[model samples]
Target chain A: MKWCTKDIILFNKEKEFVDTVVVPLVPISWDKNMTATVREGEHITILAREIEHQLMGRMVEAPPFTYLKSESMEERMKRLKLWEKNIKESGIGYIFYLTSDVDWNQKNHNMLDMIWLPAVPLEHMEGKARDAYLDETVQDILKVITESWQQFSE
Target chain B: MSNKEHDVTRRQFLNYTLTGVGGFMAAGMLMPMVRFAVDPLLQNKKTGKMVSVVSVDELTDQPQRKTFKVKKVDGWHEFEEQKIAYVFKKKNGDIMALSPICTHLGCTVNWNDPAYPNEYHCPCHGGRYTKTGINIPGTPPPAPLHVYDMKVKDGTVYLGDAHPRGGA
Candidate 1:
């Protein structure tokens, strides 16, 4: 389910059935890596949307967790842990943290399932190339997610 | 050599005019969308509106996902929302369209995923359905996927509401 009013109402009633959440962790860098930051954010947003589309009814996509590029890892994680705590408290058991930022993975890390992938530029492609890339990537992500579901249930 | 036959006499002109106008009026009355055209001043019943999604010839044995928009009236608000249906040609040479929403939890199901080839696979809870929309036993879906009310007009496939086969 999407993070929208209509889906929220459905999510409220059907929260028992939907136990998973996909959170796109996006980084913002204004002074440097501006273009790259935007590109990664765009890809993460689209990828998260496609993932939510494929996994709708079982998972609700939370709003992206955005933070500054220069922010300390401790500060960023402190903020993320709050989101994780609230989400888990709200009855969502599984949280898949989708990110193109490698920094999140390298960090000592919070409890969020940080799914880090190298930020690949999707801006140059069009038509079938873009869709093919997205499809292949989403398939791989879904595999990892389903595998996680198997183990995470316990 | 046939100038006399090509020429329209007064009687023939009146006969053609009446037939053409009468036929047009009759058609406007009988069609679903035209009930109001026939009698807008009387009571208006909500008719099942069918939207043209694709041509019948374009459908193949492999199911193709198609999206179409419908004007939905919700209380005082009337708005349009896009809907998706998987359309395919059956073995018996009939066009079939099924709703993609999984019956178990409303997630979109894909046709012929690598994990579940030749069947609709719902990645959410691993729901599986046969090619004909019947849910596989032991899967999460309790009933078969809903089938769209369809019509073929001038080789175009027009789909109405998807009616669920209530039996599990």
Candidate 2:
């Protein structure tokens, strides 16, 4: 029932502190030079679970999730199996990390504001095959994110 | 007023007005120059720049390192040739494109090195990109070499600027 300028602490059905999240928060996107910013006093009435779900959705939307590097022995093996099966599965791969000043899940005008995901077909053993996979992966990712947002809003 | 004083006043006023107008007109002419100087600040200069490689037919999927040039357009001027490298492929009768610029530091990368046959090596700073353009972090490159946007028509490949690796 109480609120602070920056974050709001929500009480659960049991009157226990369920979650404390920054207010007026925009999740990080996959664009460059994005800063995680918060206002001192902004509040919204929403379940902590909903926010967490949205946050995870945003994180899933971030880049590097769909990138499958075949150079790694493990990745190579995974791709080999996928290639053999010819079945498509989705996953995330992080090859490098950079220190960001913003919240890792903030959304901005461009996805780069939070994370830069370049989805490629992770199973292609060859270059063109990989490009086609990338094209498909991107299309699928966009669809998933769009559907998630619509479902969350509803 | 004395005749000489009157004449001097007239000339001085004319000189001041003429020079002032001339200066104003000159500055007006240089508006484009001013904009040129300050435009980069207001613009995101690093977005979606295309680096060209070879025609799609010249590059093969077997991983050959081919060096080429991209004719870049800068304002009203065009640079004849800017060096670039790429790997090209025909996958199931489809053309695909890749860049040889190391994702780490924009260095030209070599593929299928006899010494390090398993990896793509950058001799400049010992950075290594995988055959698929993944930057091995411990190496010099901070990221992967970019991939150029491309289209194939009649077997000729037209490339766009290098975009961030993965999918950007």
Candidate 3:
């Protein structure tokens, strides 16, 4: 369910059923060349929202963790691990890290499954084309999550 | 001369009293008219309104997912909302329309997913329900799927607002 009040109340009672938590990693670059990074952040947010919408009952979307682009890799990883530990302790068995940051490698992460998507500029496109692109991306993300779930169950 | 100036003219007093009473009578007469003008705006607009979805002849025992657009008014805004319902004909000549949303967490449930054949399966949390939308106990859903208010008119089926069932 969503993080909204109405859904959170229901999610609280049915927390056992929700085994997955999706945390969106948004990167913020304060430098002058922040346009591309900002665009990537927006894209990842939309992707994460669509994934949560597709798998609402099984997944709860945690508030996105915004990190500075200049932050060290070690520090970011440490923060992510702490977040993962807290989420796991709350009864979520699966944790998904969704981001458009190509620097993140899923193989390096032990506790969370990372879905890395390349940054594609969507500001130029609108209406049907943008919707179709987003839909395809959402399907791909769902497939990845479903495969992970299958592997986990097996 | 000062006392005479203080005394009011009889015709002026009569005119003042008549105008005050006339204004009251006019306001009383206009009150209902003003209410009537804005009555619809003040009333609740979300009352269940039936909208036709499909024809009776096309319905089979197997549930068919039908999407229909219904005009919904929320406060000042009015728009058409696309609603989906699983419509099927029962063995006893009864028509049933079930909402596709799972009661567990409001996820859309599909009929006969790969893992659970012949039952409505929610892809989100593996919640399953019977053909009649009754939630299978021990599953994630706490209650049964909602049933839409259904009506048939001239061989066509129409659905109204859906209500959640109390129990399985």
Error of 1 at A92 (Å): 1.6
Which segments of model 2 are wrong by more than 4 Å? A1-154, B1-58, B73-77, B90-94, B166-168
Model 3, span B1-168: residue lDDT tens: 468878888899999999999999999999999999999999875658899889999999989988776787788999765567999998898999999888877777878767788799887767899998888988888888899999999999999999987746
Q: Give all TM-scores, in the order shown.
A: 0.66, 0.34, 0.69
On lDDT, the stronger of 1 and 2 is: 1
lDDT of 3 at A99: 88
RMSD in angstroms, all models?
Answer: 11.8, 21.2, 5.9
lDDT of 1 by residue, B53-85 (tens): 999878999999887778888989997665779
Using lDDT as the yardstick, the better of models 2 and 3 is 3
Candidate 1 lDDT, A52-85, residue by residue in tens: 8877889999999999999998898889889989
How much is B109 displaced in model 3, in angstroms?
A: 2.1
Candidate 2 displacement at residue A29 in angstroms:
60
Sorted into a CAPRI-style docking class, model 3 comes out as acceptable
lDDT of 3 at B87: 97
What ordering of candidates by TM-score runs from best to worst? Answer: 3, 1, 2
Cα lDDT tens digits for candidate 2, A16-74: 21211212212333434222211100111121112223222122111112221213435
Name the regions of candidate 1 deviating beyond 4 angstroms.
A108-110, A152-154, B1-89, B95-99, B110-119, B136-143, B146-168
